[model samples]
Every structure is written in structure tokens, then in C-alpha cells.
Target: MSATGHDYAITRTLDAPVEKVWAAWTDTESYGRWASAEEVVLDVRPGGAWSSVMVIPGGARIPLTGSYTEVVPNERLVMGMNVPGRDEPVLMALDLTPDGDRTKITLSQTFDRAEDRDQSEQGSNMLLDGLTRFLAAA
Candidate 1:
């Protein structure tokens, strides 16, 4: 559970090293391999920008853009995620911790309304699942 003022939070433990999991989130090519996105551009530094085009199952493409507010290598990442046609960007925080030979990842997304967070829950979990599988195969 996260007390980061987020509307939604999900946690997953990956059977991969912390450094490997960290790279999966921060590196462009690694992220593209695991993320549910058609294309990804990640500049993983504070104030750096990142963007991705999420390909929905039914061929819908949603463009997402964000800027990193905080980036602590292999530990935490905070970003402002821009929603399509929305002026205010949602805040997202990702925290990583080492657990033996594995990594524990907690992802939190803050939205204005509970409905919005509910709507995003499934996709967010799917994203983490995808990461888990990717890491397992790596």
C-alpha cells in the first residue's frame, strides 16, 4: 500500500534484480520491450521528458506524455503524466525496493476522481504484469 496521496496503487514483486528492474523502467529500449506501448521515448532524469503511444487491444492508439519530477536510480521515480485532452497532468510515483534476489515495485497514480482511477486500474495492472513477464524472460 502507498500513502503517496495517489488515487490508485498497485504493487508487484518481480523475480529480477533491482538493477535489472530499474533498467526496464528507465531505459528506452527495455521499456519498449515490456510496456504496453507501440513506441516509447524515455529521458529518465529530473525535468526530462518521456512519451509513449499506447496501443489498445482494439487498435486504438493513445498518446501519453510526461516529465520526470524526481528520479532516484534504482529507487524512486516521480512523473507528471499528461492525459489526452486534459490540461492537468496526473502525478505518478514508482518506488522500487530490493527483496533478496528480486525487486518489489509499487506504482501509484493520482487522479482527480475515483472513477478515473477505477477506469485505469485494469490497464495499470496489465502493464505491471507485462513487466513481470518481460523480466522473467530476460
Candidate 2:
């Protein structure tokens, strides 16, 4: 998919079929494995709720809550994430497209400030890296 004027966009190609990639993304058990979350609760449907306690570096646990604004099975997912101390929720869109035997994934996040976009890039990359490893193992 093309850019959607999101503040931050990260693209990755996973060495897995579109079906496997989509399952890893939408399934709470698979997602928690890739995300390294302490806990995860995902209701994968439009208007559903999702939350995760991410265990970042130094053993710090960051709680993130979000609601799904859109869900289109293996094609697309849009969620609004509520992070602590943030006045507005960050909107994130996950798009998946099949590329032969593999899958191309785009993660686009919309933030209100440029600093927020810049600050999130590293963490996003780390998450993608984790996902790649997770898929490789699977």
C-alpha cells in the first residue's frame, strides 16, 4: 500500500507466507511472543479492545491500551493506542500485502508531534526485528 500521510512509516518483508504473518499479527499468543510482552489481551475485531504490558529494557513494564478502529483480516488493521501521559491516542495502521511466497508489511503510525515520530522509530524497528526473528523461528 502507498503512504497514507502518516507521521511515521516502517516497512518490512517477512520470510513467511501472508497467512502466517497475518496470524502472528492478529493472534494474541503469537503477538505476545514477537512483542516480548509481559501480558497481552487482544480482541481482534472492529471496535475490539487490546492491551499489553511491554517489558522494555531495564525490566520496566509499560502498559499500553488500545482499541481496534478497523480490522480486515489478513489485509489491514487500524488501532488507536493510548499511552501514558499522552493526551491523544496514536493511530497505527498495519497493512499486509502478499509478495510471492513472502509477505510485505507496512506499519504506519500517526503522531501529533515530529519528536514523537522520531522517538518511536527505534522502538518500532526493534519490534520489527523481533517479529522477523519470531517468524524465522516459526
In model 2, pairs of residues that clash are: none
Error of 2 at 122 (Å): 1.6
Model 1 alpha-carbon drift over 4 Å, by segment: 1-6
Q: Over all chains combined, what TM-score does candidate 2 have?
A: 0.90
**lDDT tens digits, residue span 7-124, model 1:** 8779888899899999999888888878878679898899999999988788888898989999999999998988777987787789999999999999987666667777777778
Q: What is the number of residue pairs that collide in model 1?
A: 0
Report the Cα lDDT for residue 41, model 2.
Answer: 93
Q: How do the residues 57-137 of candidate 2 rate in per-residue lDDT, one tens digit apiece? A: 799998989899999888998988987897867788889999988999998876666677777877888888999999999
TM-score for each candidate, following the candidate numbering: 0.90, 0.90
TM-score of decoy 1? 0.90
